[model samples]
Target: MNFQTSFPSLRKILVGIHDLGRKMAAGADLSHAFIMLDGSYGGKEIASSLVDEDPNSPKGMEQLKVRKPPRQISIIRHCVNTALLANSAELDLAMGPSRKASSLDGQSRFLPVFRSGSCSEIGPKTYMEDEHICIDNLTDHLGVGADFLSPGAFYGVFDGHGGKDAASFVCNNLLKFVIEDQHFPTSLEKALKSAFVMTDHAFADTRSLDRSSGTTALTALIFGRTMLIANAGDCRAVLGKRGKAIELSRDHKPNCNVEKLRIEELGGIVSDGYLNGQLSVARAIGDWHMKGPKGSTCPLSAEPELQKTTLTDEDEFLVMGCDGLWDVMSSQCAVTIVRRELMDHNDPERCSRELVREALKRNSCDNLTVIVVCFSSDPPPRIDVPKTRVRRSISLEGLHLLKGVLDSNG
Candidate 1:
């Protein structure tokens, strides 16, 4: 069944801000769902008509019958007075506002994403096992295009072993490289491959400073309707889809055939069914000592499996973490807790903190990293790719366009 109506201006404006704020506050520990917009769902017309049109679109509209009268009335009012005004304000801001702000200067129509949260303790052990990084600048955005610019957003975790060098290296450069790659593929798969290889080489280049630094990486990239997920090592990604846990990525281990083959090809040995008879993980970013034989064709292959999935309403949120959090919590258990948290708190990052707290409570022994990607709001439309694609360096000028839209709408 379908029901159509216009949203009021003010209501539209506020919905955007309220939704963005909710997302920003959510961080990594919450569940989210997106609402799709049909061609018939006219924001401007809805905004203008909602103030006067009957709350009931059609007398026999069965769907409308099920909705509460107050909610229906409020929806119309919201669309007109807030949503529409905010949307217009955003567009005006994007186009370059001529006048100074007045009563509405403080108001933001677009909703930003939630901030991330974390915690750690000094255990009796002489060393530290927990590691983390939270960049609010990146979390609140997706990406932006001509038709619809998306806010750029990503989350990641690196579980370090041997030492903290690996994990720390990734947290510092992974996102920067991905965004800066001149050859970053428009396709998620290709882009991810490029990123993995580039990131590996970047580490190798840094060997001059510290050859032992390497990390296990699990990253989630959210842009438009595509969610690009890439992973190497044992870090895992599990999705909470419609309240059920769905494993989205594989955990590479020593026993896996691919890992075994790669290990042997790189001149690395497996003893006691372990990588070099030490680490149980088959794939990892660093560990030069465990890499290729003196002069073999094999090197520390950091090949990552890149998956691109078109998001839908059924897609809720994703949990990406080092084994620390996963070691202590089952996918289902994590989802349940996050789902409950979202009920009480709509922020994703706050949910992330709660996850870390839960892990610490369970006494996870490894350094922990967690990245959560929530599909809570309607994503902007896909960018149109020109038939004759011209590659241009993404520069400050190009980036400004993104900032402009985000500042206006997001």
Candidate 2:
């Protein structure tokens, strides 16, 4: 068959396979077949297969569906590998030789090591209500390379409201709860979810902690090449890739439609863009005063929405910061500043400091905390290309006409 002519179809098939792999990894029932391939590719006959099991043999298929833990992990890894390979192949075909050559140069290089830096400032706020944590080596405390566990990094930014107690408590105890969860390292999503709930409950149980105080949480956990982000409230996490800013977390504000619906459903009201006219954030760690009765759900939920994405060569760095920075600067603007700083200084710490400084210069009123996590060993190298300006030579007749017009005007 002519592979070049069938490339597009082949790419689509690979994408479908990738999607199926992800579904299987997520524990979706695979007994029922959903995909159908009945058409010909490059004049070659294609076979069709049913993904669903036979109606008469449901019990047999059910028995086969019980996968062992190791097998499950293997399937997920295989799916991820296949998807990456397909994507790389598609990219290669889409790019011409010149583009491919450029990719081989330093312009498309991937980092060999991961480094992180953080800075926090009590801006115009009366107190330092923002807290952050950076764990370079998560495995230092957890054993190295256990079954599903791999060495990774943990980073978070907690933006406090009402008081600093909630932020401080979450910053100190959240990671502990994540690592200690029964699903740690295996099912990352479960581990993170359990960790958030556990942290909320732990804070609520503390008699000394102020129940009226609360804080928004944004966390990024990098395990191997996979990233899992959990966010509650308005703090944000942005990823820098190829000079572009990609947001990894969503702000949980009271005005958001989804949040407003949930709040009203729970018999809570939003007034002037604040939850119950008191807190601007719809979700948080401690505001026990706004919660419903014990064992009952509340409009002000502590639950966080999670996001997952895999790291690639194109990914550069990640910026986690409180809303103070975002209030004055956009995600792309921040990425541009950080990229320029990294290029000039080759220092993530300095880059973060510059971000905080820029936010203060813009007149942010809240406390600010910024974390810059670089995927490279050193700050990303500056790619300096000379500028090309277009110039045109004037004809003799045109020049004479221009001179005549100038003389007339004078």
Candidate 3:
């Protein structure tokens, strides 16, 4: 029978059969075979196959022989179609399209899709002082109403200074505070601010953790189709959008004008590019040793500045990393490397691992932590845009005039 033209839906079944045959040829043992044929058609068999259940088969022995019955092919076709339909339904549920692509102002936009991966490395640092978190579904814990805010995701990278205690504490408890705040599930900005301040104060009150240790916090919270990013230190967040890198957080370096002014106004100094000649970041969490008396304001604040934008299809993924990665690679360079790796393997975890490896190759001396949150099921597709060219020519008359001026000067 010409199964190719007569039964187009059986293509996958045939391919599966071919694969099974290859496995059998490669020494796979089969234990049983069952064939059911219509008894109404004189009990004629439509198909039959032999299986060797013996475990002690000799080399090159024939274990399977498929027999084609003289008639009743219709029974075989019906069985195959039934099996194929079941498999097709499963495949549709597992690998079906989940995102809707739209357009906004001539640019492609996609609804937010939740898929994230993370990787961290000690690199050349004496200890792993960096930490990160990936909450795939915040609503699962927050129990927020859909009308107030749809289910969301969160990614954060913390870079510790002085020690790892602060980093560890914040990594484990920051999200908890954020969700438990009274304003949570409604006002994310207010909730995030209160969480950071509360976490900082809580750490300060703790006598077990190192009081002098601090960590830079950078977080990306995705609620529905909107993304809200907040940062309180040198840790960074960069968005990969249409093959370009867009920074979402500013590094809180003491040299920055705003940081410098804030530090000096709080009776602090930015001497030798360091805040108060000690810390390098002007903002952080759990640097209680550098802060003023409990109620008074301090130079090294834990308040994070927030940036919010609606996510679109053009936004590929977000890279949240410690300063260790940024120390050796520019944001665009990191994005380019990750984008290329994602295109090759479509694995965000692998892409983040590659970023850490690249930073190590460039001689970064700090602990590295990176989280990549993809906005779609797969990595962003590469688009090749044509470059425009311009040509300019000088007229003969204009050339003669130029030559006359040169000759007169000579």
Candidate 4:
């Protein structure tokens, strides 16, 4: 068999292979070509063969498993199917296709899946005046009839001044009041506004509690993809949208131009950035001593300003923190730091803890409370910074001027 004579035989073999590939590409069945081996698929080492196929399990059924994922992953939560599986040690946790992917394909929109973490510290303060709350599963906590959207969450950071009574009270009862209002589950904005005013009035009525104490309230409530932020006083809510800082709530301080005008219109005085030369914030709750009556408008208002936005894939997380954190750190800095931390390890609790630690390092003078709520279990993707080429050139006049100056000095 000379090499030149064997060329036609090799061409025949290659042609035959090409025809087989085309047939496979046309969806040809090749089940007979497959071989079963222990290393081929994830399963227990059972003494079984291809001939011993169980009728209960159809072809490709073994690939669909109901697996309990690792504890680190909190994003993929719901079980849409009623399949039971065993031998967790042998199978991967991918259970099935991504519910989020399927849901997006069906709805043609983005929906938020919320998970939160929080940390509070009495840093550099003798007494802790900051109180915060985190509720990841509002329906389970408040019952199913609460009318909240599925996959929802609520977060708040309360900064108490004068005492801890107001902050603690709001942290405990604010949500309850909001949910129990007549307008709740229907008009959330109205319900939230009324709840703030009512909470203040109720505090005024409670003789045992310190009505003179006050707190700045900031809350972030999410239902499906929509997020509503309510704020009064200086505590802030900042949304981390793909490493950029999007301020959700404005800091209501005495020195703000709008607040100053409002205060002056209401006959309130601002002296040295303090309203009425005593309180630092323009609006707050539980400061009944400064207010006139239950429903009457006053300089020191309890009404909260609300802001709402729909969360999208670009929206990564939300940062709700008292002024302690913002006093020393910029919102963009915090967002950048938190995004980096999440990408390193998708743990919001650790992210919040580290954020508090950062504020402490910055010498923040007040009590600190920070809540970090991530929208997905997966970490944020890295931001690709566009590379720029900066061409540096000097003018001939500048060079001549430099030479003249050198000659003069000589």
Pick the lDDT winner: 4
Against the true structure, candidate 1 reaches a TM-score of 0.57
TM-score of candidate 4 relative to the true fold: 0.69
In terms of lDDT, the poorest run of 10 residues in model 2 is: 39-48
lDDT of each residue in 1-410, candidate 2, tens digit only: 87757675555555555666776789977534221221122212111122233323765344334322232232332333455568767766887776768766654344335688999999987888888999877766456553344558889999998888999999999998987899977788999988888898888898998878999999998877788999999999999886667999888999999999999998999999999999999999998888865457988888899999877766889999999988878777777777778878778899899999988987888898999999876666554344548544653334433543343335
Q: What is the Cα-based lDDT of residue 4 in candidate 1?
A: 24
lDDT of 3 by residue, 327-353 (tens): 877777767767777888888899889
Using TM-score as the measure, name the better of candidate 1 and candidate 3.
3
Best by the TM-score measure: 4
Residue range 1-410, candidate 1, lDDT tens digits: 22223434546635544654575577622111111111124555333232333333563233333332442332333322355568767877876654444323433332334334444443334555435554444534323521325554566767666666766777777776776666553555666677776676667667444546556777777655566778887888887665566777787877688777777876777777687777777766766666653223453457787766655655667777777767667766666566556656666767777887777777877665666666664322222345556675653323433443343333
Q: Return the TM-score for each candidate structure.
A: 0.57, 0.67, 0.67, 0.69
- Can you give the lDDT of residue 126 in candidate 3? 80
Q: Candidate 2, residue 388: CA error in Å?
A: 8.7
Arranged by TM-score with the best first, the candidates are 4, 3, 2, 1
TM-score for candidate 2, residues paired by index: 0.67
**Superior by TM-score: candidate 3 or candidate 4:** 4
Model 1 spans > 4 angstroms off: 1-125, 129-149, 261-267, 293-300, 377-410
